[model samples]
Target: MTADDTVNQPSIALNSEVSAKCNEVVEEYRAGTASKVDAILRLQSIIPRSDDTEDQFKSALQSYVGMLDSADQARASAAKRGEQHDRSSSKRPRSPPESDDEDISEKPAKRSIDESRLPWVIDELLHPIELPPSLRLTRESLQLWSSNPKQYKASLTNAARCPEFPDSEWSNIIESKPINLDIVFAGHYSTSFDNRRTEKLGELELTFGETKPSKRIESAGDWLIAWTKASEALQFAFPHRERELREYGSYVTQLFGAVHPSRHHRVLQYEKAIRRRVSARRDLSLTDFSRFADLHLLHIDSSGAVALDEDSRPQARPNRGGDSRKRPGKGVEACRRWNEGRCPVDAARCRYTHICSTCRSREHTAEQCTNRARAN
Candidate 1:
């Protein structure tokens, strides 16, 4: 055959193979060996195409199967009539268009988007600018303004006459007394007084000695106002001593001292509890329970306690219970879990030696094995 004929022959063979597979699948479905849906899937797997084409293959397969059903019935009826009757016209199947319409109705149409208009669409983009924090005019600034009444009043009047001062702003300021003389001076004055001026004025000198009791009583009038001023000046003058001054004539110190111990204890206890919890969690995750399955410890010391496993090696452990040996001379076996004659000792000062059954490795006793060390 020519090359063209050979290619065509393969195509025909492929079509025949696909048809045979489809028939085998339909037979499986009819025999109750496989469901109709699974048969459709098996038929689709034999074809080389995407998932979208599977439905089309299923429709064609179903139409062919329906034709086979009709042919079987026609043959059965024809055999009974023999050649005496001809039912060719009556037996002819309907056109496939109706079946195609039924399949098309079962599948919904997919919608596609138009991408051409995407670039022309306008989107509103917002750029937000955060205003820097407005400078806070403190009581110090207002105090300065109050000290210089003329300057303070002039500044307020100028601000009120400015175009930026709206009617609402003016009314609110006027009603609420917004222009505090102290805060105005706070804004104008430097954080520190110039040392040059104080030195020049000879006001740098301070009288430290205490005056008479009568004079102390006399200064009470101005003292009240000075003491009642805001935290800024008091903090500046006294530094760390201000909080003590603020709590003057109150039980602040006594109260603090009274509850301080309990508070300290509570805080320490909470920290210890947290540490224990974290350690317990870590131990739980790292612990190998399987390794300790057969672990047993024998204790044979009186003054101290040690663990010994079947290996006969000693391992140190924390002391929870009191010493087992009542007298320093009395022999002791302190491992509560000790079984049979095996006894362990605290390796720190343990004198006697013993053996372990499970681990076979030997050193101090049954209580001292490394495996028991890890186990208990």
Candidate 2:
């Protein structure tokens, strides 16, 4: 109607336009086509054209951005928790058999090594060894050794002749003594022999004959022990077919239940053990043995610690002695006492060179120097 009213009318129209734009942004956000950042940007653009004061615009923008940030953090935390739960669930061991249907008997029989001659072989090998009465082989130990006769034979023969433990002492230890599972599974402890008992057990699925109904293992431990015996039998019977043995070992795990994925290394160890044993028995020429010895020494010098690579092969690490060059030099001062004969000090605690000042030799101090003695 008047000059002031005319100016206010356009301001009212601009505020309505800004309000409409704000509402459009809110709808776009709700529909999920636009993100919270886009919504905030849209809201900020509207603030410049709106009727609101500068302070009010600033306050509103800060509040909205803070709310959006809090919501985003909450979503991220929930997603992280869900991922962790999924990882743990995946790692949990498979549940035990739900019914008798899952029992070992229900599985289809597969062709395996024949161990019928195991008893005869074991008896023939061990009968001549004059073991102390205390160390007489039990049925269980005999069964375990039957798996790897070559290793067991080597171990038993060596144990019988071990000079460190006399027959009388061995007899005393084993007399009325229960069979040591450690000895049974590992054979006798020897610094020279690398025990592959655990690895041998893992390869049981590939090595031994079909699981007999009579020997249906009731527990996982017993099942593992039986497999160890089977692995040994397999090794003894087929020493040369390593590639086939490895493929069969992997296939066996797929067919039969495995111990655990974490323990899969045990199966790999068996392969290494077999290779080492096979290498030992195969008569190599002096030159070949020398080459192997050199390679082994190189492996030792390469690294102090042993580790497997991606291919499950042992990787010889490069020597880490280079790090020693970067270390700080010793800051010890010369010992004044070591230069005098009267100074009573131990070599380790005395940080200085013990050379005599008069003779410039380490054997005696200045006071005890032969030149000084002669001059006096």
Candidate 3:
């Protein structure tokens, strides 16, 4: 054989080997056998030095190095973000629930949530007992956002979802929003994976608690989780709409339902407050249609329930649901806003029949609760 043909064979064989290795990595990654980190290291190990690589091997070497660099960069970006998340989460202490008997500390409070001696929050975030396939959320949405920040911004803006906060406002926008659900679907960029992980630890950054402002976002995460979980509840609550979005009308309601998290958040919040314990969600009574699936604001007051839309009233109410509890009488009622520990400044004049928020007595506020004092 010619000397030239003999020389070319080895390079071709080596190039094929390199390509084969890369293909193996792709398969392992896709099959979930190898982690991104593992895959990166494997690719990096085979990359040759450009300076010493033979001319034939140079092209393959550059390709190898290029992949190695990209994987390293992606790995670093993801790791940095993971560290940030770890640092942020580690700051939260899982101390026992707060007690009235405990001494007040001059030191900074761990969080803003006033746990216990209150009405309720789900033991954990509540998802509907069953989930529909359409509502299955994944990181793909965030991936799209990450690949093109501008596209994410415009889509979120057009959908009326909050865009990622600017660096300046990131720390303090928790209170700028009315409720945690307002930012329930809030997305943030991960430098490690260059991902915009949505609703998946999304709360590490902020919260939408109607009850408290965030400091370390621990309480905010809880609040955000509570609100975020309501998405599935809404879907389960409204079958007609779910069916419409799937089978009938403009999918506008469905699109908005999935995208507009706060509206559902508010509806569920109201339902929880109104029902107190044992939410049967009877008769779509939980739905505040004005806000539910509505694409635009309509001179609405979020403070209390608004009138049902006439056009929607006939068609909107679900005919039946699980059994409901009796409405609380005015005199025996518990004020949820008061229990939240974030009652508006004008609460004294607030309309509602009332008993003590702490002890369920009519005599006085929780601090001065006559029943507790008597028991003590």
Number of the candidate with higher TM-score, 1 or 2: 2
Q: For residues 158-215, could you state the per-residue lDDT of candidate 1 as single tens digits?
A: 7533432222223323232322212222223224232221122233544333111111
Each prediction's TM-score versus the true structure:
0.15, 0.19, 0.19
How far residue 68's Cα lies from its native spot in candidate 1, in Å, is 9.7
Q: What tens-digit string does per-residue lDDT give for candidate 3 at 1-376?
A: 3324433557556445555665577566656587767776675554333433445244443444444445556668989999998998979776774774564443355544433211121111110133333322222332344455645444543544343332222221211112233233222211222123233352364423222221111122333443334333333323333543233222223433453443443333333233222122222222334434332232123433332332233322222464332223443467665444344322223344334565665433454455666888
Cα misplacement distance, residue 194 of candidate 3 (Å) = 38
TM-score of 2: 0.19
Identify the candidate with maximal lDDT: 2
- Over 1-376, each residue of candidate 2 has an lDDT whose tens digit, in order, gives 3323433566557455554665566566656678998889876776442353555456545544554555566678989999988998889676888888668468666657433223233222212244333223233344465566556545643754333322222222222122122222322222233222222543362333211111112233533554454344433333443344455455434523543543333333332333343334323211223334433332222221222222354333333564411111233333466553233333322335445556555444565457998988
Error of 3 at 251 (Å): 33
Model 2 residue runs over 4 Å out of place are 1-27, 35-37, 48-52, 91-376
Query: Residue 316 lDDT in model 2?
Result: 30
Pairs of residues at least 3 apart in sequence or in different chains that clash in candidate 3: 77-191, 77-192, 78-192, 78-193, 180-208, 330-353
Worst 10 residues of 1 by lDDT: 119-128
